[model samples]
Target: MEMAWFVIVTVMLAMYVVLDGFDFGVGMVYPFVAHTEADRQTVRASIGPVWNANEVWLIAAGGVLFFAYPKAYAAGFSGFYLALILVLWLLIFRGLALELREQVDHVLWRQAWDTAFTTSSVLLAVVFGTALGNLIRGVPLNRDGYFFVPLWTDFQPGAAPGILDWFTMLLGLSCTVILAFHGANYLVMKTEGLLYQRTVSAARILGWMSAGYTVLTVIAVPLVQPSLALNFSRNPVVYLAPLIGVIALGYSLYFRIRGRDTSAFLASSVFIFLMLVSVMFGMYPNILVSTTDQALSLTVYNAATDSYGLTAGISWFVGGFLLILTYQIYLYSQFWGKTRADDAH
Candidate 1:
């Protein structure tokens, strides 16, 4: 039951990453993709209908964690309190920028919000990637299976390391680049005219950049957290996730060059999904690893809630998720084609 919930949580988070990542990527490159007011409006229209719904997955995943592993949820939330608050503000600003940019007629007003949208999205991607790095690289958990981390310390990866060590920063930058690539792919699929041309051209370069950084990060991972090496060593089959990620990445670029936006976009999404799958595989069973002490790692069994709670949680989750999935399908179907600046929200 615990393992099942872990899988559920992982899938939910992965969904958030893949679904929202392109939006973040799109926002990051908003200025570059748009030359006119209509171009910017069209870019906004492409994501306007779906961005909010995409974020619901993150909230759902957090709720599941709270129910399934209350202790870990508490510790993680408290330990990363400032970071979480920053993420919240980013989400808020991004949403407001999208809504208010259209509501105001003044050029300066819309531009201000546009800047907010792009800046917030880029920072959010970096923060999320860094957070994942911290999770994979482990924290300084003590004997009681709890730890607190400041923004940084000595810029190291060991027990008193800050949140922005060289390794975590690498992970953050990797995520940012790929998300920009992902966003470019999305724009190519959803827009027309000069915006499409620019996005397509940028996507190719960004795709290669994402792939290169991913390779560098893969090599750096073992050096930053050697324990992740133990997981790969134990389960040879787990390597398939990363392998698929590389293949999807290459396929995405090929499809993009061939002018198949839909295929390229799908491939980009798959690459992000598989990348997370590989990370989860490498850190299996351990929700939060310990850098301070090996014995303090938070494993599935150690951190799970009582059996009764998880069993009840699973039953409720299944029923609620089916409804959510149905609505999402209907919503996407309603807005399936290319978006124009004049399209209604």
Candidate 2:
């Protein structure tokens, strides 16, 4: 049951990344792809109907984590309290920038909101990537299964590492580039005219950058945390996840170059999905690693609630998950196809 919940939570978070990731990507590339007000509106319109709905996966994942793995959730939230607060503020700012940008017709107002949107999006991507890095690098979990990390400390991932180490920063930058590429593909698929042309050019450049960063990050991962290699050595099948993810990224770039926008977007989605799956595979059972002591790591068994609670939660989760899944499918179907600048308002 704990293992089941682990997979469930992983899937939910993966869904969030694959869906809302492009929204972040769009925001990251908004300024570059959009030249005039109409271009900006077109870019916004591509994601407008579904961005908020997409975030529901994050909220649902959090709720599931709280109930299914209370210990891990508590430790993660409490330990990363300051970082979480910053993420919350960035989310709020991103949403407000999206919703309020059109409230007034003033050019300065729109530009200000645009800047806010892009800045918040980029930071959120970096923060999320850094969080993933911390998870992989392990934290300073004590015997009590809780530990705190400052924003920075010696810029290293040693025994008492900070959140923003050199390794984490590298991953953060990689995430930004990857998401920018993803967003560019999405724009190419969803818009036409000069916006499409600009996105195509952007995607081409970002694709190469994403690939380079991905390779750099992959190389650094084993160096930072040798256990990842040990885990792969134990379960060789897990290697397929990242292997296929690389292939997917290659296909994304190929399709983009070939002018197949939809295929390119889908390929990028697969790449993101598979890359996350690879991480989960590498860290199976262990929800949170302990730098202080391996025994203190939060595994599925140690961090989960009692059997009764987990069993009860599954019933509710199934129903809610289905409803959300249906809503997302219907929502996307309704908003499917090309968007125009005129559709922004």
Candidate 3:
């Protein structure tokens, strides 16, 4: 049951990344791709109908974490309190920017919101990537299974490490580039004429950059945490996750070059999904690792709630998942195809 919940949580988070990730990518590429007010509107319209709905997956994943793995959830929230607060603020600003950008006709008003949107989006991507890096690199957990990290401590992933280490920063940058690449593909699929051309050009450059950084991140992962590969070594089939991710990334670029916008976007989605799957595969059993002591790490067994709770929650979870899935399908179908600046919400 605990393991099931772990898989459930992983899938939910991965869904959040693949869904809302393009929204973030849109924000990241907005300034570069949007030159005129019409261009900005088109970009906003492309994501306007679905961005908020996409974030529901993140909220649902957090809720499940709190319910299914209360111990790890509590520890992680408290330990990363500052970082979480920052993320919350960024989310708020990004939301406000999206909602308020067209409230007034003033150029300055729209520009202010535009800046906020792009800045918040880029920062959120970096923070999220850094959080993953911290997880992979381990935290300074005590015997009590809780730890606090400052923003930076000599920028190193030592026994007593900070959240913004060199390794985490690298992943953060990589995430930014990858999301930009992802967003470009999405825009390519949703726009026409000059907008599509610009996005295609951006996607081409960002694609190669994302590929390069992915390679660096993959190499750095094993160096930072050798234990992450133990499961892969034992069960070689697990390697397929990353293998598929790389193939998807290659296909995204190939489809982009062939001017197949939808195919490229779908390929980028697959790449993001499979890459996250690889991370989950690498971090199995242990939900949170401890830099202080491996014994203090929170595994699924140690961190899960009572068996009764897990069993009861599954039924509710299934029903809720179905409703959400249906809503998502309907939402996308309604919004399918090219968007125009006049369509901005």
Error of 1 at 333 (Å): 1.3
Q: 1-345 in candidate 1: lDDT tens per residue? A: 988988888888998999999999999989998989889989999998999989988998899899998878987997899999999999999999998887869989988999999999999999999999899889888787678888888877887878999999999999999999999999888899888898888898998999899899989998987778889889988888889888999999899989999999999999899889888878878889888777788877889999998998878999878877888889889988899999868
Give the poorly placed runs of model 3, Cα more than 4 Å off: none
lDDT of each residue in 1-345, candidate 3, tens digit only = 998999899899989988999999999999998999899999999999999999999999999999999999999999999899999999999999999988899989999999999999999999999999998999999988899998899998889999998999998999899988998999888999898889999999999999999999999998898888887898899999899999999999999999999999999999998888888779888899998888899999999999999999999999999999999999999999999989955
TM-score of each: 0.98, 0.98, 0.99
Model 3 Cα RMSD, 1 decimal: 0.8
Clashes of 3: 0
Tell me the whole-model lDDT of each prediction, alpha carbons only. 0.90, 0.92, 0.93
| RMSD in order of candidates | 1.0, 1.0, 0.8
Task: List model 2 lDDT by residue over 1-345, tens digit each.
Answer: 998999999999999988999999999999998999889989999999999999999999999999999999999999989889999999999999999999999989999999999999999999999999999999999999999998899998988999989999998998889988998899898988888898899999999999999999999998988888789999998899999999999999999999999999999999999999888878877899898888999999999899999898889999999999999999999989999888853
lDDT of 1 at 228: 81
Candidate 2 pairs with clashing backbones: none
Candidate 1 deviant stretches above 4 angstroms: none
